[model samples]
Each structure stands twice: as structure tokens, then as C-alpha cells.
Target: MMIQMELSMLNRNGTLVSEEETEEVTGIHCENLVIAFAVSNSPDFRSIRIIKTIKMCSHCHTFAKLVSEKYKRQILIKDPNCLHKFKGGKCSCEDYW
Candidate 1:
């Protein structure tokens, strides 16, 4: 559920740039959408599960681990490539992503 912040990049002077340029400069295309959902939903549940059709990007993957550790809860994220279990600042993939 990660959402891209910008569909296109803007320069410091506000000129638009290519998506490739944006990705190269930021190394990020998406932000963690699950964290917000998890925090709001956690009070009613002990664990959370997320399903994604695309591969989980590296940043969101890391954020999931942090959220899991901070909340002392488990997060299960299933992306097309793998299933990740995040807990206590660790991931089943061991940060290999």
C-alpha cells in the first residue's frame, strides 16, 4: 500500500525532472502505508497482516521492521517475491532487501 509521493520530480528551482532522475536522487519511490494502518488497527488486534501485489521496496521494508519493534507486535507482509515477518527490529529476510 505504499504510495509514491510524487509522480514526477521537481528541481530545487521547481523545474520538473524525469522519474528516473527522481529515483536516482532520492533512492525512494514509495513510503510505508502499513505503519499508519497498523497503529490505528493494532489496538484491536495482536498482529497485522499486509498483502501487496508488487515487491516491497527497501525503505518500506525497513520501516516495517522498526514499527514492529517499537510496538512489540508482529507484522506479516506478503509481496509477490517473498513473505516477510517483522519483529523486534528484525525481519525474516534479515535485511537482505
Candidate 2:
């Protein structure tokens, strides 16, 4: 994900809800993490949208669901549990957890 001011702010304030968004992380915490960035041509943004790919845990599946519904975004998460697609307030799990 793009390192926004939010990243530094969270590091300084220790208000980070999730360290999975940090840089140069090591150890088990660092495994299966992929962060990428892409820019949009929209005049309003003149900036890139950051994308993060960390292996989601079961709980983050819920988080992804909420985020997709709230923001109208597409999130395809790979986890030990399953591949999760959160789109249009719908999940691919079909009631399975």
C-alpha cells in the first residue's frame, strides 16, 4: 500500500490498528505480504490508489467484507481458510466461515 501520512502517523501515535501495513517488516509477521500501488487518471485524485495484499486471517475476512460494503471496493484475499472475494456487500463464502 502507498505509505500515506496515515502510516507515519500510526507509527508515531501507536494508534495502528494493524501493523500489516508497515514497511520492511520481518519475521513471521512479514510472510505472505504483498503491497502495490497504482495511479488513476481521475483529476480529483492526481494520485495513486494504494493496494495491499497480505494473507488475510479469518477475522480479516470479516474486515474485508465490511470494507467492501462500506467503500464499494473489490478485495480478493488469500488466506489459509480460503480465497475471499468481497464485492457488493457480498462474500463468496456462502455462509461458511
Candidate 3:
């Protein structure tokens, strides 16, 4: 089954940050909450797809890549800017976005 989730904001240190704190907090960005949900609910789903209205931040992108590699699952994310296919600890965007 395919699952879609809303992103949550987190700081560089992995602490939850509020939306109002985003501007002043330079290192705050969205977190990959979908991965956690997928892990617990969809063991048979090897490939995952995510759609976001905004471009994914670097931290979330890296998290997705690492999860894909560690779990041996393929993750495809489509954002407003580009499509990121992550596998084997690498992303199709090559860290461009």
C-alpha cells in the first residue's frame, strides 16, 4: 500500500522546531516522517513514493537516502523542484536539491 504523510520541521540537531521558528533557525528543515510509518506498516512494500509541495531540504533528502540504503528499499520523492530517486545511499539529484 502507498502511504502519504505530512512533513515535520526539525533543526540540525534533530530537535523538533516550530514553523514560527523556521526563519530565525537557519538549520531547520523538514524531517522524513514517512519512512518511520512505512517501516512499521508496510514491510512488503519495497518501493515508496512521496509527493511534496515544496522542495525537500538537504537533511530530509539525506535521511531518505540513508534509509533507502540501510533498509534496501527504493524511495522516489517528487517535489516542486525535482524528482529524487534514492537507492543504495545515493540520490538521483546527486545532492543538487
Candidate 4:
């Protein structure tokens, strides 16, 4: 599993936030992971599954959605918070997680 420190997240209110009151969350950066996966794996393998220990950052989540649409592939990312399926320029989380 990939990991990185996250400076922000969305609270229950659906607002973008950084947990300054406590500390920044740490998580995987899916974009770089996906790029590396693509580089190491065959192009014929269109779908991918990633198991992460923490939540995904917003930028990487958006990138996953865009990349999945552009490449016409399915990306399934399972993190501590939830499962995210990225395809057709969208994520199953709908940008909530």
C-alpha cells in the first residue's frame, strides 16, 4: 500500500478542511501510484485494485476520476475510510470521501 501525509480532508459537513485542530492525516496519493502501476503493468491490463491504509487526498481522487475516464479503465481503491471506484470522470464517493 502507498502512503503520504495529507494536510486536509472533508468533514461531515462536506466542506474542504485541514485538521489543524489535531494533525494532518496521512494517506496514499493515487495519481502517482496509478502512474507507476501503468508503467510497470501491461497496457492490456485495464483495471487495477489498490489497497491503502489511509484515506486518499482530493487531488489524487480527482486525478483518478479523470484518468479512469481518459483511459477507459476501472480503478478500485480501498482505504480505511471507504472504497472508491473511479470511472467515466467520476468517483463512487462523489467527492465526499
Candidate 5:
């Protein structure tokens, strides 16, 4: 859910955006956004599902951090390379050395 939202938000409009743009994207308030495709408003589902099949992107990392802070929620993003958990003002990279 979080990861997918990150990916959709990243891969939206056929262009890859920058970190700054990601944060900026979050601030985007659109009437159309409310009617977006991600119809499920389940926060638990959001945390459980891995939105993108691929691993998290570098830019998405920063965006995830900002989201965790802004909403005061925990976001766990898993990639081919690592499993990352963001919460409590810290990131736990799950013993990935």
C-alpha cells in the first residue's frame, strides 16, 4: 500500500520524479485525487501490501521518511536488496550488511 502509493506517485504521468518532487507531490491537493484508483482506505492493508513488485527506489526512501514523520506512522518497505522499517524517528535496516 505505502510502497505502491510511493511507486504510483513516483511513476505517475509517465515521468520519474525527484525527491523534492515527491515531497511536493504529497502536498498536492486535487479533487481528482479523492477519486483515485486505490479505493481501499484500509490502513492495515496499506502497511501489509508491497505496492510495487520491485524494490523501493532511492528517491522513495526520502519520501517514505517524510511520510512517516508527517503522519506519525510506521512504513515498512521491502526491496530486492533490503528490508527497511521506518518509525520513531529512525530506520531499521534489518541486519542487512
Candidate 6:
């Protein structure tokens, strides 16, 4: 399910790359992929909450902000380190994490 979601997201965002070019899209994390999939498929949802086991990287954080802004949805991501609330292309962390 996760793999499918990632593939779908990569395809939709035109981020899918060949083996040698994988580094170019390293910013596309699992959380970002899942959230993108959920948002795209569930139009009725106005907000999204995600629990991540590890601390989210800066790229994932930025991705979440972008997703929230693009979808006009509030996104709450709780990782081991902190709670990140994203809305209108901004994150509660202020890019600290």
C-alpha cells in the first residue's frame, strides 16, 4: 500500500526518476507521499493528521507545508520530536525542525 502510494505520488508530481537520478527526488518522503495520496483521493477531507515514528526531515516538513497550502487543508504531523501544524504554506515550527 505504501509503495503504491509513493509511486502514484511520484507519477502525479512528476518526481519519479531513474535509479541514477533518485537523489534528485529525495525530498519526497513517505509521509509526504501518504499525505498526497490521501488528499488527492479523499476530496471531502479538509484536514489531515499523521503520526510518524521518526523526526521529520526538513524536506518532508516543507513538503507538508506545500501540500497544506495547495490543498487548502490543515495538516498536523506528530513526529517523535515535535508536533508540526502546517497551513497556508507555513509550519508551526517555523522551519526550526
Best by lDDT: 3
Q: Against the correct fold, how does model 2 do in TM-score?
A: 0.41
Candidate 5 per-residue lDDT, tens place, 40-73, comes to 3545324432333445555556555555555555
Provide the lDDT at 42 for model 1: 52
Residues 4-74 of candidate 2 have per-residue lDDT tens digits of: 42332255567754546554342223212221221121232232223335455544456556655655666
Ranked candidates, highest TM-score first: 3, 6, 1, 4, 5, 2
Model 3 per-residue lDDT at 70: 86
Q: What ranking emerges by lDDT with the best candidate at the front?
A: 3, 6, 1, 4, 5, 2
Higher-scoring candidate on TM-score, 2 or 5:
5
Off by over 4 Å in 6: 1-28
TM-scores of the candidates are 0.62, 0.41, 0.70, 0.61, 0.45, 0.67
- Model 3 lDDT, residue 17, Cα: 66
Higher-ranked by TM-score: 2 or 4: 4
lDDT values, one for every candidate: 0.70, 0.46, 0.74, 0.66, 0.48, 0.72
lDDT of 6 by residue, 3-47 (tens): 233232344567755422333455446677678777877664557
Local error of candidate 2 at residue 79 (angstroms): 1.6
Model 2 segments more than 4 A misplaced: 1-56
lDDT for 2 in candidate 5 is: 35
Mind sharing the TM-score for model 3? Answer: 0.70
Can you give the lDDT of residue 9 in candidate 6? Answer: 31
Candidate 4 per-residue lDDT, tens place, 1-97, comes to 3333344567778888644322344454444455456635646345666666556777768777887887777888887899999878889998897
Taking every candidate in turn, the Cα RMSD to the unseen true structure, in Å, is 5.6, 9.2, 5.9, 9.1, 8.1, 7.2
Please write out the lDDT profile of model 1 over residues 1-97, one tens digit for every residue.
Answer: 3322335678999999775566569875432544565566557346677766567777788788888888887888887888899888899998775
Candidate 1 wrong stretches, greater than 4 Å:
1-31
